[model samples]
Target: MKKSLVYLAVGMLIFTICLGSSLITNQAKAAEEYKISVVLKALNSDYWKSVKAGAEAAAEKYGVNLSVIGPNNETQVIQQINLLEDQLVKGVQGLVVAPLRPQAAKTVLEKAVSRDIAVITIDTDADFEGKTSFAGTGNFQAAEKAGKYFADILAGQGKVAIIRGAAGDYIHDQRVDGFMQGIEGTAVEVVSVQPADSSRGKAVNVMQNIIQSYPDVNAVYATNDEMALGAERALKSANQAGVKVMGFDGSPDALKSIRNGELTATVKQDSYGIGYTGVELMVKHLAGETVASEVPVPTFIIDQNNVDASIRDLTKAFSRDRLEVLFGEDVIAEVFAE
Candidate 1:
């Protein structure tokens, strides 16, 4: 009986030690800060850089470790996938991505989900099965607004050309579809549709070619502000009569262009809001809170009527005073000028 009691006591002590050690290990894991990653389409534009700033701001606010990376340009599908896979291998607790191409990254995102890593999409939505949520603009509605405004300005009777972004991009397709829907049953005839792949130089070349073929083109609607600005430059060079230029993304350059009467109008998506909300939602999700599956930021048209207010808002969002110091006033003016 004494021997039996000794054995029982020894086993109980060992079991207590093991339980204590397990508890300690679990507590350490619970205390460890979550590492989150934000993978964007690319960091090539002011818009994306602003998104990075917003995400970083949120990470700081919520006490999470955050990493942001992207390809050199939007066309780097393979590069983007490789970067995402690298983040997965690093064991990020959560992920936010703006996929260059949806299907290309779907498999990798699914793998991440399988590993129980939370995935959120920003700026662009992915059709992945296990995506936690999407934080982006309603590109279709915004494009529709621009199209209807353009049609009204043209009095529903004019020749227009469209400069498109990357082919097969879901956002771009929706924008095109929305524009078509907005202009349906109107006399505004869409004369030319060309793919610039969202490159400013390519847009310039394409716009120049369109002018050569359709000299009477009354307006040009570009899927993005960069292309719109490039088209404007091409029009100016050819001395084409002020063909109304409409663009998307209320980029700083675009706002400045509106101020200088270079660009007729542009639809401004809430880029900062999208980035901040994406990280905020990820943090909430990591904390075991329920979050909406779709978060759509608002967008509006910025034209001469409200361009000044838009500039003020952007200055606040992007820290314009600092940007001016980094990139001189002349550079700012030139980039946004007519």
Candidate 2:
């Protein structure tokens, strides 16, 4: 009986040792899977915040080490490049970036690709040949759809003014050009097209100037929601009524404005999906799988007719419980507040 009891004790000890060893092995493997870094254009806006939330959700789901960083604003092209360089020096295995100026980041992204790091672009595209994939809206197509809708609403006759982003920004250029193409055959005439550098304050001033020059302007279109909101403020301050205003990016503020009957309409891009898919593509690439060259997130028009439903969907998507599931308990409050 004593001999049998001793043998049982020895077997139990071995089993315990094996179990602990197996757990450690799994933990180590998980850590070794991938270390991904995401860089966004800016973190100062609701649209970018939503993108961050999506990236965080994807990181949790994939059980990967993820770090997201961004400049203070989208116009800090040099700063964005510097951030990308810093991440490269950190030896991260994967990189997802939304380049404020794609051309400026091409060389850095090329170096990353040369080092065998998976590189994915989100919200913008770079011409770097080594990029793994791009995840973003088809800006031209989405804007074209918005323009068509706007023209139909105006009965194909209106004097439209365009407020675009930075002069050289490819994304904004596409949107501006696409919108023009969309309104080509209609009776709409573009009174003025100007760049607001994508800043709300700048857009406000720009809109004020446009209003001064063209008091009879029938409508306005902005490349982004921030500028649209700015235009709305300018129009209200000037007491200019009956002029339709449309914006891109179905941002939280834009939806609210639409609901309140302040803004006319907006083209809503899936900002969250862009961030999520950018990281997911990097993961797949790191795992030796193929990813498409471009992954286009869908966009649609949102106005008073559907703003309420859209708000409901957004609330559910960003609810505390859902955010907790994606971002954990500690980060729930921070993300929810955003």
Candidate 3:
């Protein structure tokens, strides 16, 4: 009887050890399976592509499974919402998104939060509850700075027209309103404000119309580089000279335009930083670390005077050495090869 009891006790202890070992193994595997999804406003633009690159670098650094998806363009608000819903259905552990329309994303993002998924907004922000953090430029402040610069350059007096992005987009609204506020005390007159749906082609038509109505307009401010480039084209086509054009999102083409004295200046947002920080914050939040509600990336104005330096700085930011540092031995040599 005593020998039988000893055997039973030892067998029970063995079973307990095995169960604990299996649980630990499962936990480790779950950690390794961490998945993150990045949804952008659009993947068809250089600015969003830069953001994607930064997110890729961060995913490599953190050793997480990452997937990025987006609509064809920023105006496809419903498409973006549907994409987010699909990601949620996929049971993503983390989500980073640049909402085309914040309100449209609110309910879906709230659902994500309810599922215990960490949510971070990049480039554009949303007021959804339980959002992990926002990692992007302070649009209002940046646009205000651009406006003040314009006011100064135009000697506080000029006929200025504003070309906006998608109608009712919070990002563009903040920018347009901020620019208006910035020039309020100055003698600058806003001759027109029109929406281009954030499309370069649409902006060309809008600019042509503005030129027809406000033929003496001294300057134009576009909420984004695409629209600004279109405005510049329209101005050039019309033989309009000496009209300063300001753009946001200091994109590569916009920088080149500035260097060539086509576009006057642009507000340069840290697009890479926005992507990287969004992922970093999501990872940190998933790891149970506290993160700030707002993570403001840097922004500055780039123009003819600083275009060369800005280009050099951007080149260095994505140089081979920097890539190696960010991605370590996993960096693909061919991708950075001269």
Off by over 4 Å in 1: 1-32, 323-338
* lDDT by residue (tens digit), candidate 2, 135-225: 9999999989988988999999989999999999999999998899899899999999999988889999999999999999989999999
Model 1, global lDDT: 0.87
Q: What lDDT tens digits, residue by residue, belong to model 3 across residues 85-159?
A: 999889789999999888889999999999988889999889988988999999999999999999999999999
TM-score of every candidate relative to the true structure: 0.87, 0.86, 0.85
* Model 2, TM vs. native: 0.86
Ranking by TM-score: 1, 2, 3
Task: Give all candidates' CA lDDT scores.
Answer: 0.87, 0.87, 0.88
What would the C-alpha RMSD of candidate 1 be, to one decimal place?
A: 8.0
Each prediction's total of clashing residue pairs, residues at least 3 apart in sequence or on different chains, is: 0, 0, 0
